[model samples]
Target: MVALNMTVDSQTGERAVRFNIDALVIAGWAGRNREAMEHHIAELEALGIARPKATPTFYRVSPSRLNSDPVVQATGENSSGEAELVLIAADGDLFVALGSDHTDRKVEAYGVTVSKQMCDKPVADRVWPFSEVADHWDSLILRSYVIEDGERVLYQEGSVDGLLDPRDLIKRYTGTDTLADGTAMFCGTLPAIGGVRSFTTFEAEVEDPKLSRTISFRYDIAILEDVG
Candidate 1:
């Protein structure tokens, strides 16, 4: 289990907990915009998947695949990163964190779920209580930057409202209103600025304009030589 140094509350007292994660669920095609969803569907069609009937598709991943390290290794050179808003459920409480739903692009053509299993998912160590940001949730923004030939350029940016809310996504996935404790879900991402492309380094964050705080994380990619 991955233990998080979480902040429960600050105004009342310095309440913290070591949140344990037992499941990692990836929520795909979670866009609230039908146009954006069609755009993503067209993009994924180029990768070999047909149009999906559901607004949000749930993919279960091994909890052991989650990591907090700032670096991850993948086979060959086709892995790409998609910045997502992650939901962490711990002991009946919900929290939010930033995450990269890093996946193997080459393997994606074969199967999205199988491709999801090909890489380790990385998340920020810091998190915000869902209660604290629930009111101003739509104001939160998600952005990602990637290093291309030594320069950091914006890759993806949009408001969190672009995707389905945590409550709806949780209910859709779990068949309930609340996510069970020890469950972590990676909410889907927004479209890239230009287009999707692989990079050596990726940085992403979730910015809370109302609170004036951000939860961000950066990680380097190591492309191991393909033996085949």
Candidate 2:
């Protein structure tokens, strides 16, 4: 299984979000076509998109490298080999950081869940209500997806959920007015299928002002047949 832990800023340090990811689905894909998968990974590296030396690894795409390369864009459509690379090249400009991983097992495929910890606070407090704080959190989550693979999406279906607003949490912990309106922040995560393409959608809901909630959903479905 693909295990992930997320901590949201709380008055007492940070709290973890509860979720599960099936590793079998990923492993099945890898097992069925390891060579094709490796070739696709090679294409990614050739374009400067680095991967971890181990399984269940995380990766990041530098903004500087992505903006300055042309070959990177040209290689985005080489079948499943270029799925992750295409997503990064298309969406990497918006994020300060990106994280991804894979596993070796076989099971049902659901989706990914991303949690947050308030590393920094906004400039002011009481300026933006709890609902607005939740909205800001939603915006940051939407901006975090940098991969734009036409075939494979970083997220599956109903993957993103349980976003906690740090406004009150930051204020209580820091004892200062840190979360103000229009304050900039970064948060969220993306799960990617190395070779295939997938479709995705984002959504949110504020159940309570005191406790905020948001969910970013992604779905995988066949869009077209063979065309080259």
Candidate 3:
């Protein structure tokens, strides 16, 4: 089990909490806009990944993959990070944070679930209470950037309106509107601006326009030598 120390940002104020997460779920094909979701599926299909059998598919990986560190290592150079909104249940309350569903592209072509397990999942250190921003949730924005050749380029950007509502997604995945404590879910991602590919450093953020607040994190990817 991995314990994550996260900060909660609410109207009342901010507090720190540590949770020994028991479950980690990555939700896929969860775009509320069917056209946009299909577009992302096509992006992966072009890379030889298969289509998911159902909409908003839930993938369970090890809780140990949950990481809030500034650095992550992945074997080979075929993995990349996609911006996502993570729902974390803690202290009997649900909070939302920014996440990067860092995945391995090569293994994904043959084994989607296994690919999701092959790398560390990066998460921001802080989160907003679900109820605090529930009224303005749709206005939240998700954006990511990748540093290539010392130049930062926009990777993915979109409003949360493009994806399924957090409550709705939770209900579909768990048969209930509530997420249990110690569980964290990566809700979904937007289509890459250029395309899905590898990067040495990835930075992502979730912004609440109405509240003028944002949660962001950056992680450098170190590719280890493949010795076989």
Candidate 4:
């Protein structure tokens, strides 16, 4: 396991603090066999093996039990490229995990959403349908960092502005929407030594010369630590 030191900067310089993270062990049983894992997973309609009532008795394998494999190819182009691959277990089950590398620090999970502007007309007021118009608007990125000791929560919030680089691919992918006037938003939360959780919201916009209006966009992020 690796310990991380997070730093915050002020007009003067930088201040740093150490965070202690205990190594977590996750264990879980795969499907009956490697070939049956997917079939059983599909039959159970479960995402991964986290569902409680799912069949095939899947379990969460610990980090120590995780096998090291070669890096997979990147998924989408731009700042937010991702890779998906399978982990083969000698015992007969297949474990799946997704890898997203967007910064110097390692991230366990993330989410993204995109939305567009709304339009009003004499006939009817409507918003851009993402399925119909698929281009427009800018993206916003939200990220999470583990805060240890809870020394400067309020001060850290003010310092978050400088922690991110807008041009990074990971930032772009997670923040941009595919649809026009699309509003993209992402929220990520990292617990004191647990898996990171993320959520996204998207909106679409409609364009028309007759009734054009400016849209207001906003983004908010919240982080909570010490979750078991």
lDDT of 3 by residue, 1-228 (tens): 789898888878999988779999999999999999999999999899999999988999999998888899999999999999999888788888888999999999999999999999999999888888889888999999999999999999989898999899989988987889889999899999978989999999989989888899999999997775
The alpha-carbon deviation from the true structure for residue 69 of candidate 1, after best TM-score superposition, in angstroms, is 0.7
Scored by lDDT, model 2 comes in at 0.24
Lowest summed lDDT over 10 consecutive residues: which window, candidate 4? 114-123
Ranking by lDDT: 3, 1, 2, 4
Clash number for every model?
0, 17, 0, 25
All candidates: TM-score: 0.93, 0.22, 0.98, 0.17
lDDT of 1 by residue, 1-228 (tens): 766665554334446568788888999999888888778778777767667667688999987778878889999999889999889998787888888999998888778889899998988877788899989888999999999988999999889887898899988887889999999999899887777778889999888888778888999999999999
Please list all clashing residue pairs in model 3, or write none if there are none.
Answer: none
Model 2 TM-score (2 dp): 0.22
What's the candidate order when arranged by decreasing TM-score? 3, 1, 2, 4
lDDT of 2 by residue, 51-167 (tens): 434432222222122211111211112212111101110111211111222110111011111101100011100012223334434343322222355432333221223222233
Better of 2 and 3 by lDDT: 3
Instruction: Give the top-scoring candidate (TM-score).
Output: 3
Better of 1 and 3 by lDDT: 3
- For model 2, give the RMSD to the true fold: 16.8
Task: State each model's CA lDDT, in order.
Answer: 0.85, 0.24, 0.92, 0.21
Residue 154 displacement (Å), model 4: 33
Give candidate 1 misplaced runs (Cα > 4 Å): 5-16
Compared with the true structure, the alpha-carbon lDDT of candidate 4 equals 0.21
Top candidate (lDDT): 3
1 against 3, candidate with superior TM-score: 3
Model 2 alpha-carbon miss at residue 217, Å:
15
Worst 10 residues of 1 by lDDT: 5-14
